[model samples]
Target: MALWIEAESVERRSNATEDDLQAIIRAVYRQVLGNAHVLDSQRLTNVESQFRNGDITVRNFVRAVAQSDLYRSRCFETSSPYRFIELNFKHLLGRAPQDQAEIAEHVQIYHQYGYEAEINSYIDSDEYIRSFGEHLVPSARGNRTQSGIKNVSFNRSFTLMRGFAANDVGKSAKLISDIGGNLPTKIVAPSGASGVYSNTGKRFRVAVSQVSYGPRVTQSVTTFEVGYSQLSQKIQNIQKTGGKILRVTEVA
Candidate 1:
């Protein structure tokens, strides 16, 4: 699971609806690609349809965005190594570079393996595999910054700590384009003593938390578990809802 501020905000939502899927697609356009116009493109529409139909996961949707021609022109083409690498961290991993060295490390990859390889590195990293598996989306949390906040895993409410919110013009714009904040889904490991997991399926079992937002003035966001197997559905829920997940376990 991926989130902007805290890790606890992410979860595996089995009850995600068509509206939630649409909202999620919008979230991807604004947050991952940073171009609202891309939402109108047939490519994105196709990807959305595939994801909604379960032909793809949020992780696959994310991969499509990064590998899309739109992302190449907007993010990679003609950009400095530093700028490109930094954007990759934001778009692919959903966070900024941990430090100059991290940037340098990625830069070296870009130089040696070409742009595509650089992109794959982030998606293929252990962090991606462990936190998100292949069915979740990535969101920004100051995972690498010296000013990063301590990660709050799945259990209790998580507040977006400082340093994770991007300060740059484009970065801030992307956050604004979606819903002016992060989503309520996350991919995290199980919590406490191994929690529960079906002895079937080849993927990880994640604990999911449901999220909702209200009144920007109040900065009101709330999350809870309506039940173990399902969550509250707002129906075509155009509201912002996503977070970091915790206590995930690999099943069968």
Candidate 2:
């Protein structure tokens, strides 16, 4: 529910102490790329140095991580341009886009300006500065005012560490585009739970184990089955925001 810097992490990221600044940088790497250990040490250090020197804002620091070859090979290569754009929103802007209009807008940016420029566009936006300054991180806040299924708030840190973006905008768009001449084909059932038949809405579980919510809270693990279609939609929303899908099946 907290934005980029939760009250606790904000303390460290916004402080005057050198140790705190270093911790801030570490958190940036850990949050942005999903894991700090996987980053090349030199690149991580360089990014930290850039931020410390005031040469780059927090947005720029994040963009650097997402652009790194490591991230590209792992997260972006196979991703649809929409998924790519959505991750930028989750990781750099800290929210799901307002609608399909926004997604198309970013897809245009990616196609026109290319990857680095597309990333820089989000970080350099006025919204970025308004929501979080040079010292904070991006985390999903949900489109709570929107009608239908979009009005959901995500646990911020939980989204940042997600594995990969899974939104199907690109696939959906392709499906729509190709719907005309060739007869629309039936969606082949997935072998297990991958692709369109991917585990969607029928499953919902909150990460009560993460301390990102701070010590003031108490929670027991909870689980629910949302059914495939509904869970699928929610999962797509989660994917758009750089979140992970952790399956917690209930025991009899």
* lDDT (Cα) of model 2: 0.50
Q: What is the C-alpha lDDT of each candidate?
A: 0.50, 0.50
TM-score of each: 0.52, 0.53
lDDT of 1 at 23: 72
Please give the range of 10 consecutive residues that has the lowest summed lDDT in model 2.
Answer: 173-182
**What is the per-residue lDDT of model 1 for residues 193-237, given as tens digits with 9 covering 90 to 100?**
533322112333344344445554233323332221221122112
lDDT, candidate 2, 1-252, per-residue tens: 212333223423434577767666776665555443553554667777877877887767777877877667545785555456555666676554544456667767878888777777887888777667666766444423323324322322123222233332222122211111112223333354442333332333422121224556543443344443343344345446544334433222
- Index of the highest-TM-score prediction: 2
lDDT of 1: 0.50
Off by over 4 Å in 2: 1-15, 35-42, 143-252
Evaluated at residue 143, the lDDT of candidate 2 is: 29
Worst 10 residues of 1 by lDDT: 172-181
TM-score of 2: 0.53
